[model samples]
Target: MTQQHLEPPVAAGLPTPVPGRAAKPSMRELILQAAAVLFYAQGIRAVSADKIITKVGITKVTFYRHFPGKDDLVVAYLERRAQSERDAIEGARRSSPGDPAGALRLIAEGIGVESCAPGFRGCPFINAAAEYADAGHPVREVVASHRRWFKATIEQILHEIGVADVSGVADQLVILRDGAMVGGHLGHRGDPQVVARSLVNAGRAVIEYSQAPD
Candidate 1:
């Protein structure tokens, strides 16, 4: 997705300490919050340490004190994003206790809904992977770890639902999800309801296919 289409950085209008209040944000928190926004809104390579420092209104020394380098900050950014995704999935699962397929539907529905949000960009993990080409890079490692967790989570869900080919179905579902995110960002011709319905249908097909008798 184009930069213009992406959501504005979260750092904008960040809270400042009020007079006579002991609730000032720590230097580390400021740096992380700002970096997360900039990295997600702008490309990671495009955001330099100086830019982050300026955004956080901190000195170079303080920035380094929190993150020794840009790579560290990038890793932190992905970790934060990963945690958010995990929480979202967990929330969906909790909402439909004992119903794996229903939980998966909730997640698929979330992806469709999120894609339509104003200033929606594509998947952050995919975007980060594009920026960091080296598989050995710390940023790529973070992406890989997240992907592994995600795929495993999907597999576990399918397994719980008694899918015969859990691994294959999980892989197919991941492909569908990634495509939906990209297609939605590109304004592919469907309304959110249509998109969500399509996702649920495709996911149901996979589960049902596995249930078919040989």
Candidate 2:
């Protein structure tokens, strides 16, 4: 019987890996990115984990490994959004140190820019709250937490501006912002400039009225 001979493996068959190639997003980040887009564009209830998994090119097991349930993913997405908003507001505050009105104007401008952006959706927290009606739900908790922080921030600004009743002013400011956001999304079909200027003017008006002597 003839002895059998084995050929050596060739390097040509293997594809060369590129060095310093940009790293792909982690499975978790990919999932969240997809969820954020879908959740914001469509209503939260309209989106499903399966849709997110498919968009992220992940399997159910892998998806669940990162997020045990859809709600967990939703919470994470909102948390990321919450942090981003906090950063923006904080940055605005920091931009005009010792100038409360300037800081508020910067914040209002930021909101106007966001409202006028392409594919602008109404406030994510408000949208999420609308979908999850139960105040006890985790989603609602996150919404509540972010809102409380926002109101407190506004109150701090008002206090700095010598507004004695910061609570009422803060509440009014929050309501005005909410209205502007909703109007920008639903009713304000005019120029983006107009929409943005309206928001800024409305916010300023509220503050001025509150500070006016009764």
Residue 169, candidate 1: alpha-carbon lDDT: 88
Candidate 1 lDDT over residue span 26-49, tens digit each: 566667778777876777889999
Q: Which clashing pairs does model 2 show? A: none
On the 0 to 100 scale, the lDDT of residue 7 in model 1 is 27
**Model 1, position 177: C-alpha lDDT score:** 93
Let me know the TM-score candidate 1 reaches against the reference structure: 0.86
Query: How many steric clashes between backbone atoms does each model show?
Result: 0, 0
Q: What is the lDDT of residue 175 in candidate 1?
A: 95
| TM-scores for candidates 1 onward, in order | 0.86, 0.86
Clashing pairs in 1: none
Tens digits of per-residue lDDT for model 2, 129-167: 999989999999999999999999999999999988899
How does model 2 fare in lDDT? 0.80
